[model samples]
Target: MKKLLIALLTAASLSACTTTESFVKGADVGWLPQMEASGYQFRNRDGKRQDALRILKDYGINTIRLRTWVNPSQDKGSGHNSRDETVAMAVRAQRMGMRIMIDFHYSDSWADPEKQVKPAAWRGHDFAQLQKDVYDYTYDVMRALQSAGVAPEWVQVGNETRTGMIYPEGHTDNWPQLAKLINQGYAAVKAVSPSSKVVLHLDRGNDNQWFRTWFDNAKANGAKWDVIGMSYYPYWLPGRPDYTASIDDLGRNLNDMAARYGSEVMVVEVGGEDDRPQNTYDMLVAVQAKVRAVPGGKGLGVIYWEPQGARSWSHYALSAWGADGRPTKAMDAFLRQP
Candidate 1:
């Protein structure tokens, strides 16, 4: 049945629109999974994962990226998030035949460009202690996955690590320490699953200097990785509203990085839904068209970020965006991709 689905997708790709030129196609194309992805942020509830996995499979998604934190709710006025929740999600997604990727934030709370708060448990640790903390955290996570039979195929050492992770001590400002911590995460992942592809990710996919600088420093200090992943959202990235130019820049930048770092690239997170679903969808389709046009861009998949945010479920008309929200135009963009 999967084979047949692949054949049908292949035929559809060949004949679907018949306007855009086919850049390349290999035997791996059929076996290659189409990336129609979304996020499944859970509240540590049991038995909900089965339904979530079913929804993903029904949506033709084949990959699941789960985020892990050391301890999300140990502080006052803070909420709780558990690795057990993430592992449960991975197990369910795997049961549904979805490829798994584990995102190690190496922090207690949300780890993004703006936030990289160290886990309370690791605070006040020296450089050596920080390295040990990183290794133990990563190892323990992977070990938990292995013991629970939920090993991920890909392991991301950190989140949108724009300025490095485990800040102050191992932040990007200190390449020496940042590289050390990153290397520790890399070694830990390899220790558990030698075959898993380790991905080193960053924000600003279109920024030549950002990618070059980060990877150059990382490579110089021996940051092992199998993939150069990025997070691109035109709506949020610092650039003009010229989406076409932005995507064209993405292609050129990615090609440059591929040549420089010798790694496969993936846009691990994306999607935008403004005030209107139709307009959002239109913007997304145009963006997706340009994104898919990137050279060697066939396998590049995107994960819709919080497409179904909490407040927008029923009366999505909270303020500007539409009340009727589901996949939105951003999703339509993916549907129209090669």
Candidate 2:
């Protein structure tokens, strides 16, 4: 009877241990709540920066990530945001106790794997000078933010730079120059504030090979980075290779990145909320679960690009309807986490 009791007690203790580990892993995993986690994705509409700020503060988000284009030439009959405009928003974020993360796109418009249209002013600059352009622009922005009392917590040298930022020049497959230019921006950011952490980002977290190829080259050339950031938009990543295999593959790959790079891995930008929030919300929750469940996965946290913007177009077209949308389902997803 005593042996039976002992066995039962041991089983109960093990069950309790399992429960404790599960709860802590989900709650205490490195979750950086940045307002711009995926907020605008390069387009800021209706001066919605203020609304962005309020939502973040309400949700305990301590970080704000903002992207900048070198000279995003008035695309589609719209004015591009300038350095001064970025600083202005950074100051507003500061007033509310949020740390800024500056993202340099290094182009006239967008800079990613799919698109990187060089600025018209930079058309004449050679590779050597192009590297300088990246460093100089990064330095100038940091200086302005410093003077304005809005120091950045982290600065991303470039966005979705799987192939490296700045095309035909700073582009990878030309690793010698590519890595050097990346280091130049890193140096520029360091020159101003050595304490600020530098983040190196890439898209398609599902592609371990993409990260491996880039980081392997970067390591060969000695890249400087504090955090490894990945962007995972559910609709986008699954189509990359094999959908059935890729989801689990991404979770494993992220764990591998943290160990391989020896850097804290941050999802940095992730989104859900399809044409409607129900399906996407569930997907986000499942991704969150996957991260927390995996033993080696440091899974920082999943961020919604623009949960509020899911139905934004309808509102702008008609002032009569007003905003009936709140991030009710999205918020519930995070809150419902087990």
Candidate 3:
């Protein structure tokens, strides 16, 4: 009887030790709630105007990525991507049992490679003050989400920081400054939620050389993060005509980066031409295949950037929506079982 009990207990222990799947099939629907607020609706194949989250769930999207702006109210409160707004979206996604990734732009508006405008509030502050602000703000945001019982699975320190974030102060040319700011944000994230994975995001996934230089400098400068997030938008790159080749290289680069860094990699933002939905589908299939093929499965997942932007308030192109407010065939790529 004692031997039998020991075997049963050992089996129970094994079952309890089973690890959850880490692959992330995600979507950056940051504009979703705002779209809904603007009276836009989403529909599935059946033509019923269902909630966007339900549609995404049906498409096999297990994660949601939301972006937050420091002070969007500067534009007459047109800032649906504000802190409070993001928290509300997180609550809704949590109710649906979907994982969450929060992106901090650190500016009043967009903060991509070309434009990293300092928020009005922080424009006059020196570098020291900016670092402290980033730390405090990141900590406060995480605390707020924790207070609401919404623990984000991933938190990005900045968005598409190809050349670094927050302009001249934190630009890539100044790796030390950039690394300092990122470390501050990373420390804040850990302090608030030790389980959440922090991501350092950048654009142009096909550029492996760029990543090597950036990561090498970042590491040498003492920057740390759990994951490397990259954005791949074929239409926006200079070699738009060679997008197919670029897509293929994107997969290879992701694998190389993941293996080299000993860290997980995710295609945090991806979009394709709206006119060629089937082509978009094929691209997603190719990209996802490459990501999943990473050695030891370090490739985490792919995320569509604003796939529901059918006549969105921002008039952004490269969305996966049809004229009928339904997802194009391209979105079917995410339906594959993980």
What is the Cα-based lDDT of residue 32 in candidate 2? 17
Ranking of all predicted structures according to TM-score, beginning with the best and ending with the worst? 3, 1, 2
C-alpha lDDT of candidate 3 relative to the true structure:
0.86
Candidate 1, 53-106: lDDT as tens digits: 343334345577767778876432133335776777677667766677888888
Error of 2 at 222 (Å): 2.0
Off by over 4 Å in 2: 1-50, 74-79, 238-245, 289-300, 314-323, 334-338
Model 1 clashes, total count: 3
Candidate 1 lDDT (Cα, whole model)?
0.64
Residues 1-338 of candidate 3 have per-residue lDDT tens digits of 99999999999999876633467888888778767776886889688999988998788888999999887863422466888889989999989878999999988888888888777888888999999989998998899899899989899999888888988899988999999999999999999899999999889998899988888898899999999989988888885854687977887788888878898999999988877888888888888887888888788899998888764445666888877878889889987754
Candidate with best lDDT: 3
Candidate 2: lDDT over CA atoms?
Answer: 0.64
The lDDT for every candidate, in the order shown, is 0.64, 0.64, 0.86
lDDT of 2 by residue, 275-306 (tens): 44565556656666656654554555544443
What TM-score does prediction 1 earn?
0.76
RMSD of each: 8.4, 9.6, 4.3
Ten contiguous residues with the weakest lDDT in model 3? 71-80
Q: Per model, how many backbone clashes are there? A: 3, 1, 0
